[model samples]
Target: MRENREIAHTFDTLADLLEIEGANPFRVRAYRNAARVVDSISQNVAMMVREGRDLSQYPGIGKDLAGKIRTVSETGTLPLLEEVEKRVPRALSELTQIEGLGPRRVKALHESLQVNSLEDLEKAVDQGRVRELPGFGARTEELVRNGLKRLRGTQGRTLIADAEETAVHLERFLSGLQGVKQVTVAGSYRRRRETVGDLDVLVTCRPGVPVGKWFTSFESVETILSQGETRSSVRLRSGLQVDLRVVPEISYGAALHYFTGSKAHNIAIRKLGMARGLRINEYGVFSGDQRIAGRTEAEVFAAVDLPFIEPELREDRGEVDAARNGRLPELIRIEDIRGDLHAHTNATDGRSGLESMVDAARERGYEYLAITDHSQAVTVAKGLDVERLRKQLQAIDRLQEQYDDIRILKGSEVDILEDGRLDLPDEILRELDITVCSVHSRFNLPEAQQTERILRAMDNPHFRILGHPSGRLLNKRDPYPMDLERIITGAVERGRFLEVNAQPDRLDLTDTACQLAKEKGAKLAISTDAHSDSGLAGIRFGIGQARRGWLEKQDVINTRPLPELLKLLRNT
Candidate 1:
């Protein structure tokens, strides 16, 4: 799976490099979409290849992509990736990650100034060479320099989705090894953080089991940094570090709790233990010379006189006190969601059609699904104009007649224009069952203006929900400047909902923001903003974010049944 992810990354990099090289736009999009499909699917890419399955049968996978997937599965590298890297150096591809530097700018920096690496980029900026490049000004150069500085501070962390996929792959691989008894992934990865620095895996095995050799034998292991009798560290080909610890069964629980910690949370718990006349560590909980608790995480918590706290809530953010008071939140789960309110189709930028999206949602047991394609403002998405949207509404109406179990809601993800106007006319918006408005461009607005824009947009009588309220794409870009508190407060006042967009890359209305909205008595909708059927599965990621924010089913608007949901919307 790590190899699959690595290959997907190669395709993504190739796409970026191709775009910079002035390749066909469609060709670049094919690679980008293929990367998302490869990364998001649940099936194992390697297993599919080993079983002689046709990879092209998967969505977004054509003959060329299937061949690349097969090649990576078999040989663990893609020749095309190598060929592409020869044209665009890896360091230059990395430069695109800096917020202000797109591929074209990266290419300009590379060719015009011979700035191929971050070091080279810095030197060129210092020498004022970047400012002199075509299409680049002094301000842009400064932004690039600042983006580089920010990148350096947060370089090694991997997205939670990527780390989770790798962790599952490693866990399965290790469990298949001889004498392996129990395997658990601990650390920020286990806590379900948005990003993780590395993985900490705890394992217990039969006596004298040769686990160290198995750790180094993983196909994705690029290099073994260290190997010892009880512990080993390896770096995966994806540049993710993994530490494996072989613990005794007796101490496994204690070690799991200790390793699966926010440092601050663990310190607080340790202080609690000390006050109780107990010594706690990774080994076990002790009261003098006798071991008291270490057999399970529950036991460790019992020893500290606290209820078991969920990992996502173990951030020392009132969770300790909540646990002491028996008030830990019964976190929201995927099953609690009854429907998805924000989805797209081929009528817009989405890869699938309305029927397919609804079928996927129905299969997931959703009582209803919204077909919220983009409206006119987002030209790149081929967003719907007035007549086209009317036709789509009719199409959804026709599709709804064929379905007895799942209801289809006619919706539009209408763009909130630069001046706070909706992309669609009031009559068109009024025709829809629900309207999900979002900001698409002019992301550089000042905080006051951005907040005002959103506030004014929410003031529209047709607005039902604010989509991806923060305009954030994790790792790729920071959220546009806005006063979220004011925006959320406006939502509460307007009887509107905020979205926790569950796309793996854009878990907007971040956990803290979700909590703020909840605290302010503003409802939230955990929508996938799904572009494909597979994307419908992203709701689980949204659920994770909701749980971390202390949101329960009652706090999520989509958890209501159709009748109740409709009533709530109408009343609001």
Candidate 2:
């Protein structure tokens, strides 16, 4: 590690600890100084450790700082992490993710105003107390309000979807650089969280021209927070910050694994590394007194006696055991899905006509796609009545004829009204290709009532697919209170498919629920419920959630071919 990178990391870690313990500046600076020592060392820290050098021997790392380094090296975590967690509300870090808030303001608010949680902050703004604080005014308060509003309705915390595109763009750009051998987008974004705070990119480039030439070429840079030989930080045009670090090609994979983290997952792996007499960090892998492997992720894991983990499974959710035991679920793959069984058209609230949607589905090589427009009750979605639905079915028949390879299954996304009944009449439901059922309204029911309502709706002979069973939008909204286990079990017994909605905003029957449903013998369906032709791409999100939940091809009902799906539909 270069001295500068080490210093930067120390500052980064200090930032967390400072925020956690409300530590005053100087104490935090000690840790920052130690981080600088590690980051800036031209000689490997592993080599230093091998020489039996005590970190205490290094300046800036006093007895206390040395202890932290020892803990970090041995545990892959700070021993004080839990203590820090206790001192500060874990959510203070989250509050920082809101636009326009930083550590200084967060500390000021916490100390002076007792605003620690997002809810508390929201309340403070609503009560007009925040605008009264030093360095804050009505404009800042408005930004805070908008920040809360933007963050409030998310399904989970992650880099924005648009940020992902930016990351891909950066990856391609850096990879194309003359001196670059490899580049990767890492951090929380790689883990697919619903929102992100910043971007981390690792670059491995050939040794030749200095980093300055490469760094200067980025004209989109808003501000260069820092620039050095091995690492740099810059604010981008989109108001997002990007930090790039250059490493040797040999360490690219290990560096990526080290940086791409959920923190918890990395800590667990580090523990594993320690138990095996190995040290793991962004610098790569080391056995006591020896450099082992740092060339690839496979090599790093092999050094630790584990299989390489996929990015999606890096959520610290029992992946280690799954890898150790070789029972990682065969996870649903994109190709296994042969058709989309729920959709809508301009005949309802959808933007495209039936013909265009079916044509798009055919273009994707789907053998069958359902045109399940909204039923009459969902007026906001322009839901249709039986008479209009009859005309929509005729259009489906014509589209099916127009494209022989694509079969448009007549269907309707019937609303499960407040009283536990389908909005469409039984005759209309029976007339459709498939009757997909869901409760889009009445989310305020008690858990028991919600469970009963859904069970009763699933019992309808016409009901085939249960969409987004919990009606959650990840971080944005809480799931409608319901007894999930009972709902899944009853659906299993009744032989109805639980939908794994692919919409990014609503990957409901979340991976956890889908896993449970599969465990309970309930079948699962991956439906895009695409209201527009472009929205059809949402299946990709569903597949990601399914993979996270350990779903396999056989666990998903929609993975079946057209004939098999038709057989199941007819049986329903």
Candidate 3:
């Protein structure tokens, strides 16, 4: 069956092709919005189709888009996409991923230079042909060159969210099989990196289970690369390669530790074992040919005289030294989060309404939920003006009376202008319980100007948190150039907090940056920046990032009680 991601990709391609073909703007937008809506849903869309449920009940999915979803779910392809691809090269959709090449430019390139792929576009730029086109110039050619480089650099990597979806489904499938003792997805995946090249799944099962064959036979397997009694490798339909390995139960911990590693962390651990006249590998820890400790990760750590580090902290970035010195931080967990400080409603680009979002947050037992819709500067999101914001504030006031269990903080994700001014004025910002300032335009500014721009925004007394501080979109866009360390310091000096946006694609204030914030005495808020109710679940990704960054309950501002959180926001 087709996954939600597959359906979304189909619609996204259909939209891209339609736009390139100069189809109606409204038609193109419908498909684009449908893709976003489908991707945001947490439930199995294919299952819904199989069960004959009404797909149009979903936000932004009209009757027409709903039918298309059903078609893709049942057939594993979209007829419209196939129809469009025959006229417009399917590969052209990929060119739209370049920073400066939207569908119109892609169309222009195709018509003027016959550029069909990245290679063709590169050749055209090299020949100075792209710059001679009407809308293209030397700067655009440079952007294409740089974007192509970044695209190639990230070619094989998959978003962590997509990888997680595949891993979880396969893990459950294997776990349900007879005699399967354990299944753990290790490697960069287990380390919770923002993006992964592939997946490594380790398992321990009863003898003679033929787990390898079972793995190869899984429904998603598109190609069986190799198979053996204890090892197997396969490529899934989504183009992600997965390797499965079976190990003895006694060596499970050792194998997991070895596989769930950054090479540096493993090497460090091996050095520690070697210093004690012990050898450590995937099998077990040995002292002169005598097996010692390997039954559990804790046992392995005890043998090396260190505590078991969390998988997220196995990056060898001061974690080992911290472990040795007994300074290893108690990383924050999802449960520690009391509220989400960044979120949107239908008043902006969000699909859900205020009441629904409130109910979802209250159901999650949050003490507060901030409604930070986009401000006027973000015109694309239907950003709210002063009058609209005031009306929304009044609406929140009325809605607040309906639910005593959660505080709905009236807020706006105000844009930080290039010159360092907040999108919304102070009078309106002061009325808000929180202000999440962000950068939504001019991403290519030089480092000094960009740094100064944010610092100037921070000078505003009402700026509480910097939302998605780095403005990175996981495989799609690189973080704009800026000195994060200086920004962290400036945030510290101004008592402003940085945000660890929980969106799977934009876990900004990356793990490393999170650690920098923690080190520089700057606090952080791990917010979902959710656009839909289901988007609230993205908090898990942020928690993983925060854990990788060595954040504790104290380092996160929203981990506090409602009153304390309010106090912190006010003080900022």
Candidate 4:
């Protein structure tokens, strides 16, 4: 958002996509390498340029890229980007959304077949035209065809939380084994991309035994792609692919450092390690003579004289440096989440009853899960009216007694009507455990109007949090314009928690804005905004974005334990 590497990587990635579409391998690598550099820098690239600092001073920022970064900074738009957008369907990047289709193939199809969209790509494959391409014979074409078929009508990318679910599942499986020392997720999944491309994992085990044997034993084993003493790749029944590597315990730290990649970050660390005469790889760090790490991820990092880095911050963007300087922001953990402040039940579109949603939360290790089904204003959603609200309150009382450990918070995701007032009556609002005011319609409002609409709702003391503050749907719709800074500032001043809607389509108070909220000393509530029990899984996605912002448990409102959460919510 600020023209830093995280921001630059988008453009650089776009550059690579164009290069791939342009079919220039070397240029693609250059743009990718530069993007990685932008991602790895600890300082703001855009800010540095404004100060007249040599943009190329950063390791990955070359003279050419320095120019590109400046253009983007000055205009908030890149001309090259516009040109590429015209030549390629910006959604062609969505082809990257399809597993097994790299930019080259995407470009190839775009170039060779005029396959502009998934629809066109599917048609080409079905017609057998895709089989005619170079290196793409019958089998590869069938693979592409199957991929499209499998994903047909799927409206959104797999949420980052979904990937984390798989990661946790694998972590549990591997951790349960006899010889395993530790397991962790690595790659972009660990970085918490809104939509993960695939899952990459790193595990540490005692050496002198084959870890591949353990890989063959997982519940969803489809086929082993390749296996060596240290690394293996495989597919699962769900069509997700995973790569696993075994490292000695001592190398665990460095192996994690390497595998939990912002590849740019890994390269930087490896380069730093190289200067000290250490070579690092997935297995571990190698000294001039010996294989030192036999166990533990910490020992590997200690070998290089740095503290261990968290998986989330491993994005080569200053993490190693942050590790070196001890400047890393302590990230929020799932354990820190006290409750989900926004959820629904059968009263609306939710698949289960309120108690069942609470049960799902309890089973997933939450202290409480707020049930905020639609307020009466959302007639399409069958939102609760005064009478139904009373019944829900009774139901909450019954459940609170029955499930002693889990607190059932009465709440509603009340629609913020076009007139900028919450739909629920004041009497009803006063009875709720939590009140989340949101914009479900009129997303076309202008920036000033949108900001004003939300502020009007925030003026209500009952507006405890604002849901999906931006009203965005990834790959589907961009959020309506709003003065985010104004909303966060107002929310903080009013002692209201800003909601980070975890539903993938809406990672609303996205990392950038969430970080801004923290900078402004605002509290955040990370809610699943879940519609089903499994929907609670979106909580991890919110948490991932929170971590990316370098959020601490203290920075989040829900990190309050159940008692603390209750007092905060009820204004007690």
TM-score of each: 0.96, 0.72, 0.98, 0.64
Global lDDT of each candidate: 0.88, 0.75, 0.92, 0.75
Which lDDT tens digits does candidate 4 get at residues 1-572? Answer: 14343345467657656766675667676666566555434355666767888878654468887888777666566777778777677767767656457778888888899988888888898799988999788877876765675566454345564455557668877888877877787778777877666677777677565667777567566787887877788876545688887766665666665666778867776787788898777666788767765245566677678787766666665668778888878888887887788888888866567776888889887788788888887887788888998898888888888887777888888899987889988988898888888998887678999899998888887889888888876655556889999998998888888888888767888777877898899888888888766667668778888887778899888888888888887772
Better of 1 and 4 by lDDT: 1
| Top candidate, metric TM-score | 3
Query: Which residue pairs in model 4 clash with each other?
Result: 5-38, 40-317, 249-294, 249-295, 249-296, 250-295, 250-296, 252-297, 253-297, 265-316
Ten contiguous residues minimizing lDDT sum, candidate 3: 1-10
Runs in model 3 lying further than 4 Å from the true structure? none
The superposed Cα distance between candidate 3 and the true structure at residue 431, in angstroms, equals 1.0
Greater TM-score among 2 and 4 belongs to 2
Location of the lowest summed lDDT over 10 successive residues in candidate 4? 1-10
| Top model number, lDDT | 3
lDDT value for model 3: 0.92
TM-score for model 3? 0.98
All-Cα superposition RMSD per candidate:
1.8, 17.6, 1.1, 18.7
Better of 1 and 4 by TM-score: 1
The C-alpha local distance difference test score for the whole of candidate 1 amounts to 0.88
lDDT of 4: 0.75
- Residue 252, model 4, lDDT: 67
